[model samples]
Target: MLDRDIAAFYGVETKRLNEKVKRNARRFPNDFMFQLTEQEWSLISSQFVMTSRMKRPKKSLPYAFTELGALMLSSVLRSPVADETSIKITRAFVAMRQMLTFSTLPEKVVTLAQELYKLKEEVNEILADQNDINESTRAQLDAISTALAELQASRSQDATLKNRRPIGFIQPKEDEE
Candidate 1:
């Protein structure tokens, strides 16, 4: 199935759907999904005519995730459609895997495992980068909070000085008839 079709079933715009996957980040390991490099994109696009007529807003192409990636997505996003879609998609994947296992040459399993391992490494790197970014943001926020506290203290002192009133303003005065 095309990525676009699966994205639509989740009730999210394509970009938002991708972004959600990106945010969860860890749930998707490499076997589940990987970015399509230019060469890979060219190969995929040449082989498949599905996206040929569709007008894309950007020049850059999007990555395609395998069935495993789609299953990983359901773990992160909690929507009614996600549940149903996950079940259906997982079944399809299981059938495909079973077919591959039964029909494929025995020698291919080693190569497939090696590729899967590399993909998992890439997914781990993506999650690590996200964690680094979160850490940096937390540090920046802490610095900003410190600066704000200092500013607030200075402002409070100035306010006390400005707010002081002379005796005339506070003393009891007779109201003229």
Candidate 2:
């Protein structure tokens, strides 16, 4: 990336970015960044429409940055925009690296899916066992209820017999006029 483009992406002015680079000169080595020749600058600048406000002298060539240079530039720039953008760019690169590193994602997913399936099957078996226990408990409770009902009927019959008079007793009491 060019310094101007990088600065624009980082929400800083081109001049400010260059100023920070100049201040931290050792931070950017030759491989990390280079200046475009006048002829190269001319070709590049011609590609973009330059208004009167955007006009610059031929001597003022833009600095070209490699990926490392751009990252270093972000670090050198201590402003909030640069800091936040640097963190984002760093995270993006890290994510890319992680994506590349985790090439076995499918295998991991398959393993996890198998484990989950086993867990689901185990849960179903436990539920089935609990249902069997519940059914047996319900049957026992029903049997106890029926037995209690029969005992209650027999007690009620005995009570009724005790309350009735003897079948052969017919006379009224002598004391009763």
Candidate 3:
């Protein structure tokens, strides 16, 4: 997670969050919190749409906080909101671990299964809508093709008519008339 996101979750300004983190730097090891490289930042920027205001010219890259670092932030911030948010974040992390390990509670497993079914149904509906769009697009393309062919034929006929000589004798130029 980026420090800014964690700050937002903790209900603090990003600069204030960084200041707290810096104050308690000993709590965050290099692995827990580290600055992103320019290359890494560029790659992330390419993958996501960043706001122009967020694009500041900084001497150093923004810091990335690992789960441990995020947890440590709650302790450093010293606010009730931070504490509650940290607990929720911690629970989320534990839930993710449980899901990955396949050690989810029975109730959680049932909920997950239901959610999966809902997702599957949604995907099927989207595919059906896409098929309808495909058919409509095909019809439109055929109409365009027919129109182009007609236009081309008309243009060819006009060209031939323009190039053809008159049935009678050639008319004199304006100067001769």
* Local accuracy by lDDT, each model: 0.77, 0.82, 0.83
Regions of candidate 1 where Cα sits further than 4 Å from its true position = 50-54, 57-59, 105-177
Please write out the lDDT profile of model 2 over residues 1-177, one tens digit for every residue: 687778877987788888999999999999889999878877787787772225445567889987678789777986788778777766776777798779888889999999999999999999999999999999999999999999999999999987676467554454356
Q: Identify the runs in model 3 with alpha carbons over 4 angstroms from their true place.
A: 52-55, 98-177
As for lDDT, the candidate ahead, 1 or 3, is 3
What TM-score goes with each of the models?
0.50, 0.46, 0.51
Alpha-carbon deviation at 78 in model 2, angstroms: 1.4
* Sort by TM-score, top down from the best: 3, 1, 2
Candidate 1 C-alpha lDDT tens digits along 106-136: 5688789899999999999999999999999
Cα displacement (Å) at residue 67, model 3? 1.1
Considering every candidate listed, which one attains the maximal lDDT? Answer: 3
**Candidate 2, lDDT over the whole model:** 0.82
Alpha-carbon RMSD to native, per candidate: 28.1, 14.1, 23.7
Candidate 1: residue 97 lDDT (0-100): 91
